[model samples]
Target: RKGGAEMTQREFKDMPSRIARLPRDKRGFPIPKFVGAVDKKGEPDFRLVSHDHMAACVRRNLCWICGDVMGTRKAFALGPMCCINRVSSEPPSHYECAVFAAKACPFLSNPNAKRRQRDLPEAGEVAGIMIERNPGVTAIWVTRFYSLMQVSNGVLFFVGEPEGLEFYARGRAATRAEIKASIASGIPHLEEVAKRDGRGAMSELKRMRKRFDALLADRVPA
Candidate 1:
């Protein structure tokens, strides 16, 4: 089991040694835990997540990036929208691993980088609408608590109210303006969902938004 000791709270610039230890693809990006084999040769597609691995992560308390036994605190690297919904399709990863992803992963950090939607497998999608657009800011939600929720034909990580959070964009600490813009763009879509789900869901959305308000206030300036 890889003992991922807790580290200082900040986003990384160059790749850390811990991240270096992970297996890399031919292109040299660390192969995350959820990436699935594309063929019998066991070649991995970074864009594709393995459904089998996701279930295993929850059952075993494994980190989603390093594929190691996680310590007590599990961290989630998700979009700002996932933070609002408090739901993530991906399971928990190490703090450093998640930070590296948020900063280094092109899709999450580059607002302009579009997810390749063509030829995506059904297994790649989970139980929800999967707000396909990148929110342009990644929220690294660190918590000692979370729950596994079984949804239609898939699983979701019901992320607990965070012990703490850090947002990253464009390989750096995300600015308040950037976060605010991302949230502002996402809220209407979330609101529509909450309304469709009725009172209970609406109330939950409010609670999430309130927490985000507090978090956004603590944002780093550009």
Candidate 2:
């Protein structure tokens, strides 16, 4: 049988390094520091910095606009192009800042919105939607919205995040407000978001693989 100290070491090793390190912000909540000994167990303790004690530390570090935990935020090239400098109690990624800025942007504003639909799913809803829709759909992509590409059918449909409709489905009929209202009464479209994120990441991975393969082919054997 393993000794107590040995078992503790094994458990600590199994924990994620990121989680173990404990996340913190530069401006709002600084990351925890390794403090001096707490007890005589020969184990170390840490004191984490906090901002809003009312909410969870992770929640405090979430995207202010979408409430997504920073660890789980999605990346977008458009983030820097769409953002303006703003101060917040929490530290947010560039993409998160850009998203918040987009809300006020002329292109994303309510009055300036080109689409007729509204009400988008939360991140959790996006995850679930992706799992459920995976069987019925061929593939999914995350552009400005969740796109469902038909399997073996070559058709594409939008499930959530109606913003992309104006750009991708030009001249398409607008979604009815009643439908938005109906979805609002229930769960937000989480799976839809997940599908889009997953596919987008996959596409990026494929591109990376191709680049690596090309580089390998050019290498001269010694």
Candidate 3:
């Protein structure tokens, strides 16, 4: 955020309400509360998440995007892989904030968008298995039950069963065809994991497939 300009109220009016509440970074992008560290030159890196900030969100029921108090139902704007596993590396946020992020973030909104490969130790160490690739499809997974589960050196949020589910691709509601395409594109990674983890993992994959199909069956729900 070193060179970032202060966002004006006028600019806020041009953006979504929840998004306008966020402070902008040097790149003119709204800085999410979940962002934790900066690059070597002290520029904030959107890719990194701060564990302290994450914990605070869970402890206070604060929205990760806007850093505001949240309602009882917390929403997670997650990638397709996270949807299947019900694991989020970040905390929950207000529905509007999460949806705005799901649509506005280049990495989440664009299937063709690629994550930059970088090593920023200042961002701190992360726990659990990381999926370096973007999930392509974003799911607004909503629930009232979620808990922080500490991993070896970091933490993760284990989302309870979704009370509401919706899918987005390229910023708008995703069609069943699009969801299926996303699943097809992403399932290979799961298959590879199952191949390495063996029969038990394979069984889980079968169940995951069922879940995936069930979501597709609804196709964003009327």
lDDT of 2: 0.27
TM-score of each: 0.85, 0.16, 0.85
Arrange candidates by lDDT, highest first: which order?
A: 1, 3, 2
Residue-level lDDT tens digits of model 1 in 86-199: 888888998888888888886877999998866667766656677767798888999999887777767788888677788889988888888889999888889888899999
Q: Score each candidate by Cα lDDT.
A: 0.80, 0.27, 0.78
List candidate 2 stretches off by more than 4 Å: 1-72, 75-93, 115-222
Rate residue 220 of model 3 by lDDT.
65
The parts of candidate 1 lying over 4 Å away from their true place are 1-13, 39-43, 218-222
- Model 2 is weakest, by summed lDDT over 10 consecutive residues, at 79-88
Ranking by TM-score: 3, 1, 2
Worst 10 residues of 1 by lDDT: 5-14
lDDT tens per residue, model 2, 1-222: 366443222122222233334443322221222222222343332222122431342334443223345554322212110111111122333242333233322223232234212232121121111212111100111133223333341222322321211110111211334222322332223323435779875565446445433432343121
